[model samples]
Target: MAGPNAPWHQKKNHPVRRHFPFVLLFALLGLSALASAPAAALEFELGAGPVDEIDGDGTWIATASWLTGQRHPWELAVGMIGARTQAQGVDTGDVYFVSVSRRLTWKRWFVQGGIAFTDSDNEVLSNHWQFRTGLGYDFGRFSLSVAHLSNANTGGRNRGETFALLQVAF
Candidate 1:
């Protein structure tokens, strides 16, 4: 049992939520940089995968990214993460995130690394700050990739989340 004064009881006062505006500002700025330019292609991805935890079923994710018109490596994306649940159990809170990632490709095989900021906090993803990395193959109008999201022990008790994704280009 925990006392009323404990940190867990104080959601509104959490450091990340207290500083949310600053985080959102930066994320928006990064995305703006990508959207400002005329995108060569826009990509949308949908995915689901198992959560790295006990009794975890799976998690779902969707994202939108603008691929730079030329072969530029930088991309900005905004996405939503669905909550995970145990077998016939309750669901955790959903997370909304924005990320700025750079993709390096070699003959349709590509890898991406980026930093992400999330707006919600919950058991599955305890921290508001996260790091994202993934690798996959681009099959012309679509792509197959797997992305991992980690809070990096920023809030402790981190198990990280990984998802296998399918992407469509428009």
Candidate 2:
């Protein structure tokens, strides 16, 4: 006699399902903020490199960021990043994250720090808080950065990761 309305069918049974609404709300707010921004105020950056691993098996990394606007020395951005590698006997181990960053710049040079919420398919890692920091050079339309990412020891296993990336903004 169970149907779609059955208690077992309810989203509360699943942990992530229970939080879906909140995640959706946060995403909507972020999108609305971006939509209200000036048409020419968006800056985009894309970069890729390798992630260092404790076992000497590196992962391929890539990231994209959108800089919305600036306030004095601080620039605000939202970013998505991913890394992939092999673990065990399977081609596994991947991590993805969404983050917000604040950058302080001095003419052609800049430093940034950000917090990220992360998800990983790797059994050795868990969904956790991630911190990122980097320094880069801005050459007008193009830039280069060397960044580090870690769980700040908040997670039981935090080996950390690093990447050198190139960026372009319009």
Q: List the residue pairs that clash in candidate 1.
A: none
Clashes of each: 0, 0
User: Model 2: number of clashes?
Assistant: 0
All candidates' TM-scores?
0.75, 0.70
lDDT of each: 0.71, 0.61
Considering summed lDDT, which 10 consecutive residues are worst modelled in model 1?
45-54
C-alpha lDDT of residue 136 in model 2? 89
Query: Per-residue lDDT tens digits of candidate 2, residues 32-131?
Result: 5556667577667776765555455566676666666664232333443444444443233456666656678888788998765554423334444567
Best by TM-score: 1
Q: What is the C-alpha local distance difference test score of candidate 2?
A: 0.61
